[model samples]
Target: MNRAALRLSARVREVLEEAARRPDRGDISTTTVIIWVAAVTGAVLIAGTIALVIAKYNGQLNNL
Candidate 1:
């Protein structure tokens, strides 16, 4: 049982060391930025449309 625990600990250390040595691939590209902007714009437009529709209905309800 002790030998097994030592082996597991050694394996975990090796995996962590390998992960630390790997290079980062974390930069965002221009196309990704454009897509994100478009998504945000679309979400804003949808929310505005819903708000306008609710306001129109609410005004009608108040009149009745």
Candidate 2:
């Protein structure tokens, strides 16, 4: 059991070392930023529309 634990630790260390030595190609690019912004804007617009519809319905019910 101890030997197995040591082997696992060594393998993990090796993997971490290799990952650290790799190039930096995981940055968030401009296209990703634009897409995220668009997604957020669309979500806000949809939420606003739903709220407006609900408000309108409540207003109509109150008038009755």
Candidate 3:
């Protein structure tokens, strides 16, 4: 290959290696984000279930 093509291939290899060695950002690791989302979703579902149950039983509780 010519000098220009050789230089470009070397540069691309360097860039790919640098990217592979880079650390992940703290804000958005896949597993961590998924766990947090699942926890929040569970909490919201529980809260909504409790609210619905309370509403359904409101009149019975009021009788006491």
Candidate 4:
């Protein structure tokens, strides 16, 4: 068990070191903004559709 733990720790350390070597610009591009906008619009449309469907069946559901 101790050997397994050491191996795991060594692997984790290597992963951290590799990740630290990369450069990050930390800037958002226009494509990212457009993708976010589309995602939000899709979510809103799906929610609106669900709301409309529930409203349409409200009377029938209450009768049950």
For all predicted structures, in order, the TM-scores are: 0.51, 0.53, 0.58, 0.56
Clashing pairs in 2: none
Model 3 pairs in collision = none
**Residue 18, candidate 3: C-alpha displacement in angstroms:** 10
lDDT of 1 by residue, 1-64 (tens): 9999999999999988877888464768889999999999999999999999988899687888
Q: In model 1, which regions exceed 4 Å deviation?
A: 1-25, 61-64
**44: Cα error in model 2, Å:** 0.5
Per-residue lDDT for 1-64 in model 4, tens only? 9999999999999888876886454768899999999999999999999999999999998999
Give me the displacement of residue 46 in model 2, in angstroms.
0.3
Tens digits of lDDT, candidate 2, 1-64: 9999999999999988978898575979999999999999999999999999988899787889
Which portions of model 4 miss their true places by more than 4 Å? 1-25
**TM-score leader:** 3
Quick one: how many clashes does candidate 3 have? 0
Residue 14, candidate 3: C-alpha displacement in angstroms: 17
